[model samples]
Target: MAVRLPILLFRMGLGPAFGKRLLLLHHTGRATGLDRRVVLEVVAYEPNAGSWIVASGFGTRSDWYRNLRVEPKTVVQFGNRHHAVTARFLAADDGADIMARYGRRHPRTARRLCAFMKLPSDGSEASFRDAGRAIPFVRLDEARPRLP
Candidate 1:
């Protein structure tokens, strides 16, 4: 019931309003072989590279993270834009830097996110680095358009 609501809204085209802050991930379940969808917060976006950095707040055990490991090819919807992407796991140091940068940009939200994830963050780069090491980060690189 909870998940259905956002999926409905995203499908209705309200996604763009959230911009790069939120995205809908469409991935295949590794175990069930069924399609699955989830909404995730975008920690950062590299416009030059057409990539987004996202973290597995629920840790490495998150179904989506696990699923992506099995099948890296996926699609993400941000606002009204849909992009085919390949998910790549980020190194612990890189994830830490991403988190630190995100905290600087959105302090309140970052604090809430850390709290929700049961991660401790003192709003310092080092503290965020510690938390980053405990979780998993992935870079979703947008696939280039295919030429026919």
Candidate 2:
């Protein structure tokens, strides 16, 4: 089956429980200078740190990630909530640490995430080590609720 089914469910307001937390992200394309909307999973939320973490499973090849790199300021929507924020690309070391912690806390989900990212299984330290290079992390900065 195509992964499109799961992605569709999320877009249609279902299946967020099954590893797809639908996120509506708005960014400006660097080359096109047009607004873009993307759906992504929410990897982690750190209220104390005032940031939310996301992973670019497609690495630098993903368009959304590339757009954010060119223009850090963007808008995000989680469920019914929306916010204006800045995106910060995490270093390889930091991404590894975050992936390690996530793998430890949610092994099964982590493994699934690894598979989705087309990386190796989460049970392998080698895989976790490789995630830094394979899957990069992004931090949402200066997040403020979007006005309805």
Q: Which candidate is the best by TM-score?
A: 1
Task: Report the Cα RMSD per candidate.
Answer: 2.7, 4.2
What is candidate 2's TM-score against the reference?
0.75
- Tens digit per residue, CA lDDT, model 2, 28-133: 9889999877667777875555567888878888899999989998877655455678999988888888888877777787788788877777486557767655
**Model 1 bad stretches (over 4 Å):** 145-148
Compose the digit string of candidate 1's lDDT tens values, residues 1-148: 9767777789999997777788999999998999899999888887777888888988888999999999999999978889999999999888778878887888787777788888888877777777777668999999984343
RMSD of candidate 2 to the truth, in angstroms, is: 4.2
Q: Which lDDT value does model 2 have at 21?
A: 46
TM-scores for candidates 1 onward, in order: 0.90, 0.75
User: What's the lDDT for candidate 2?
Assistant: 0.74
